[model samples]
Target chain A: MTLLAQYALTGVVTGCFLILATIGFSLTRQVEGFLNIAHAEMLGVSAFITWGLNAVAGWPFLPSAAVAVVATAFLGLAIGRVVYDPMRRLGPAVLLITSVGVAYVMAGVMHAIIGTGIRSLDMPLATSYKAFGLRITDYQMVVVALAAATGISLALFLNRTKTGLAIRAMSSNPELAASRGIDVRQTSRATWLIASGLAGLAGVMLALIATLSTDIAFNQILQILAVAILAGLGSLYSVIAAGLIVGIAMDMSVYWIPAGYRPLIAFLVVILALLVRPQGLSGKARS
Target chain B: MNLVQLFLAVVMFGSLFSVLTLSLNLQYARGGMINFGTVAYFAAGAYAYAIVTQEPPSGLDQYLVGLHGPWWAGFLAAGVASMAFAVLTGWPTLRLRGEYLALTTFAFAEMLHSLLVNERRIGNGTVGLANVERPDPGSLGLPDAWAYAGAAFLLMLATALVFRRLLASPYGRAIDAVRDDETAAEAIGKDIARLRFEVFVISAVPIGFAGALYAMITTLVSPDLFTAEVTFFVWIALVLGGERTILGAVLGTMALVGFQELVRAFPFESVRAAEIAAAGEDIVTGILFILILRWQPFEAMVKRRAAA
Candidate 1:
């Protein structure tokens, strides 16, 4: 029972981080209709930016995170404008290749700037809290709460706000949305900003839990891709659920299998997911 | 530099890349499968050859089992193993369309990398296998470089001929039909899945063969050789050379690989050119890919060919 509880705790913690990282990808895919391979790199960018501010500039945690989020949001907006806008006119294959290229460029630039060395975030370790005989770190709790809050806010933004509705309209049918005077371009830019900012927040939270490395972005991006696909592309709720499942499964496998075999488990899960639910959990049936 | 030596070197490089590009083009151009795990088969071939010919380590020779197969046997075994793996994975994953399939294969490739890097017992982990013997060219009396280049050229010509025949055959037309529209092909009595699986296996054989040759050429096999970057580079070559054109893949690989070597040789003081050279290959390839896709280079080439 205790072992199960331990696994569950670890799973939830890992799931929380996955959700944070993947929610933005889910949103952006919904808005843009293509997988943004550079999403994980943007997360890395935010984490590094936050680290620099906190470690070098001596800023407090909240202030640094805020600055990183803003910076990432702007960067996301710029990417949407400069890279994606022109490519949107091309076919899906072209866009897919371009996003991959953009991802390579972003990863290269990040590595070049950050010097390719792993860096530890200097945030004070959060105290552990016990709930129902299960130990939970304060950071983990904060991450979960923040993720939930962000998710709820996003739901409200999509369903309630005029601009969010416009974004949804655009995602559903860009041509029709444009005909309805929805300003598809503006909505896309806004979606990029919000989605990438969320990714940044996830990155900061993730870096807090683990050491930051150049390859972290690529690894996390792969995981996020899996999560986004399992969730069926655009369904935000399904993405969260899928993220939780993958995280828990990954954490639980460590107990039963050798550490080296951990990656194979994720690969197995992804392959199985592709075989069983190619369209993902909530994806629309292809015509 | 000796003109003969330089010419031989370029030919060797060109032939090796031609092999890589042919396999890539088979999937990307002919079958419309965006395989990001192309290097997995290549790595598998290299490792297979390495394992078959490897002697036990000095300290553990008594405890661990070792194989001492002929080099030709090892190479053939590598190709066969790679083909088997491709068939196994391609059966299920080929059903997926577009990016999902790409992402899944990419994940599989990464898994292969991790498995190779961590499994010290089976393969030597990250240190990789070394001191494998190269194929002998005894009694040919030609220079060693010329001999190797000659053999590689023959292999490249053989591969090109085989692929051209395959592409022109009825089965090749089936592969193209499946790529164009799976449902339509299915309606027309073609088993889309079966054809895809066939092409997947066929394409993997040459890739694996090339990989085995690569291990022999370099006289080593390491986890680093099977990176996503290598697969990406192959993708770039296939795209730049005009997919579906056998000769184009050969030309494309030569140009891209030559450009990569040139970039590495250039004096760039600002960016750790080695590191950027490592990363820049993908960046340049990606840029070229986007450019070629946008401009439709193949269409223009075809027009010129028609005019000629």
Candidate 2:
């Protein structure tokens, strides 16, 4: 019983991080109507920036994280303007391929800059508190709290703020929203900035938990996609729920299954979801 | 330089890519399905041939039991395997459009790659298979290069002929109808799912067959050969030549491959320079796709051909 509790606790901790990562993917898809395949690259750039500030410039954690988020957000907006805007002017297929190209370019640049080495941050691991004979880390608890706070704030912003409402309206019908005097382009830029900032925060949290590497960002991106798809593209709540479920499933699978087979489970689940309810759990059915 | 050797190499490389582009064109041009999983079939065929022809001559292999067959049998087996996979994947995924279908297929290809990399019990893992015997030319008493080139050209001719016939057939008309308007095709009594599955299988077969031939020529089969880069290269060929046109696919592949070889032969200052220049081929191809898509070069081609 204690062993199971420990596993569940660990699962919830990792799930919190995944929920943060997936929010950007979910929000971007809702606003842009296209999956940002280069999103993982954005996370990677942020992590690298964090590493640079902490290691090279000898900056402290909070300040470095702030700088990293701002830099990554700007980078994401630039990528949106340069690559995605031109791609949007073209057909959907062209845009999709362009996104793939951007992903490739970003991966290549990251590899070139970082030299494919794995690095770790020097942050202290959060202390653990025993509960019902199970150990739960303070860092884990903080992660959960942070994720919940972000989710609540985002929900409120969407419902209360004019800009957030404009984003939702643009997501539903861009043309109609533009006709109603919403600055569609400005909303898209804001979505890109906020989505990328969230991704940067997720990257910092992920780095603290695991060894930072270039490929880590892409793996997180794939996990984010799985969550967004499982939740149905536009449902923020479902996306968070799906991320938690998948994160727990992945962590639990490591206990019973060989590590080699864990990726197979995710692939199988995504393929099955695609075959059955491609619109996802909360998605509206398209004719 | 002997014109024959250069010509044979060109034809051989051209035929391989032509097979790739043709399969891609079938799905993209005829069915309007953006299949990024073409390499899945190609890898299936190559690995099928490698396993069937060159499995370690020991123990009863359960997962791929009868895989150690002759070259012809291996080719046929690859086609059958790829077609089976296509039928299974395409039936459900064909319902998606544009980016969704592309991402789904791309994910499937990545999964297939992961399986190949991880599943050593059947596939020999990343180390792959090697030293498989090539088809004999000595029995026919011809020069090896000429014989291999001739065989490849013959395969290309046969594929081209079949593709031409299919495009001109009633089945081809149905494929185009589905591509143009899936809802309209369903309204007119066309079974959209069945047609999609059929075209997908047909397209996959050639890709698998080409993979078998590639394995035979290279005398090696590894997972690296079937990466998304390869699929993207085929896309470049299809877009450059003109999607949905068989001749365009053939011409585009030949032009692109020939250009790459020419660039490689140039005396760059360093090997890094050469490698960078080679990577530039992709950049150029991508730019060309954008330009051609915007300009619709095929329309001009149609006008020019009509004038002629």
Candidate 3:
């Protein structure tokens, strides 16, 4: 029972960051209808940026995270403008390929800049709270709370805001939405910024949780994809649920499998989800 | 090694990749299947070959499958193992279309990678299988490089001949029909799913052979040897050389690998030079991929026009 409780705690903590990583991908899928392979780099960008600021430059954590988030938001905006916007005329395949190319560039640029080594966020140690055989750190609690807050606010934004409504309308039917006077360009750019900013925040949180490395993006990318697909790629609420399930599943897999096989759980879930529920938990069936 | 040996090594590596590229070309260019999980079969073949040829580990070195066999038998085992893997995984995954199918394949490849890296009993927990036997050509009075290059070239030629015959056959036409228009092909009674499954499985054979050859040439096999980057490398080569053309695979591998070697040969005397060399190829390839996406080749244009 104690072991299960510990696993559950760790699973929830891991799930918080998984939610953060996948929400952006889900949002983009809803609006853009293509997998942004480059979005995987947004995490690395923010993590490295915050690492540079807090660890290298001796700046405090909040300011570094804020700047990193803004930087990543702009990075997404630039990719949308420079690469995606122009090539979208070609087709989704071209756009998908371009996103992959963008990912390669991001990986190359990260390699060129940092030169490959694990770098941790330079923060003081946090006190832990233990209850019911689970030990939780202050940082881990903060991560979960932040994710909850982000998820709630995102729900509010999508359900209550006029811009969010326009975004959804555009996603569902671009022609009809455009006819109804929704500015496609503005909405897309905003979606990019919001999603990218969320991805950046996830990266910052992840760097705090673990050591930052160039491989972080590559390592997390598959899991992020799995989460995105499991959530049906467009359902924000289901993304949170799917993230938690995958995280818990990964943690619980250690009981039956070796610790190294933890990553395989996500892939298995992905394949199963693709075969059984390609539309995801709450996603509408494809026409 | 001298420049000659270095170039010969490049040639051998190029030939190995040529086989891989041909497989990809056959699948994507001719068969219309976007397989992003090429590493799965390739790694399977390598591990199978290693298992067949390698001696059982005695002390600290332990791994799955250690049965000594002839090199030819190893190659055959590799091909068969790869085909079996394809059959197992492709049944459910082949039902998906376009990006979903590609993503599933990518997932499968990553799963295999994770398994290989994690399961110590499988590939020794990322330490990898080592000391794979390399056939010596000295008995035949041939330089090792020349002999290896000849073998690799011969394998590539055989692959191409088989590929060409398949393309010329009715099966190839059916695959093209599915690629061009799946619904139309189905309407015309082309059994799209079965065709895709067949191509997906058949293409794995050469890739399997390529993987076995790679293990033999390098004399080692590691999880790192079969990353998704290998898929991207082949994809870039195929796109750059023009898909569906006979010499596209060979030309594409030569160009990409040749440029990489040239960058490696740059006169620089620092660790940063090496980094630059590596990153330079990646950044250039990324840019080239973008450019290709913007303005695809004439062959693609023709295909699109015909489809329209």
- The DockQ leader among the candidates is 3
Candidate 1's residue-wise lDDT over A34-125, tens digit each? Answer: 78878998888899898999888889888898899999989999988877777776666667666767777777777666666778767777
Candidate maximizing TM-score: 3
Summed over model 2, clashes come to 2
Write down the worst ten-residue block by lDDT for model 2 chain A: A108-117
lDDT at residue B44 of model 1 (Cα atoms): 87
lDDT of the candidates, in the order given: 0.80, 0.77, 0.85
Error of 3 at B203 (Å): 0.7
Tens-place lDDT per residue, model 3, A69-174, is: 9999999998888888876777665576678788888888888888867789889997889886689999999899999999999889988998899888977888
Error of 3 at B137 (Å): 2.0
lDDT of 1 by residue, B184-285 (tens): 999999988778778878988987888788888788888877788787777777777876788888888888777765665556776565676667665666
Candidate 1 is graded, for docking, as acceptable
DockQ of each: 0.47, 0.26, 0.71
Residue range B214-282, candidate 2, lDDT tens digits: 888888777777777788778877777876678888998888777766665567897556555655654
Superior candidate under DockQ, 1 versus 2: 1
* Per-residue accuracy of model 2 over A1-287 as CA lDDT, tens digit each: 66666776787787788889889977887787777777877878888888888877888888888899899898888878866775576555766556666665666566645655689775776697986898877767778898999899999988899999998899888889999999989999999999999888887777667788877766766567667767877688887788777777766777776655655566567778777887877868642
Per model, the share of native interface contacts recovered reads: 0.39, 0.11, 0.57
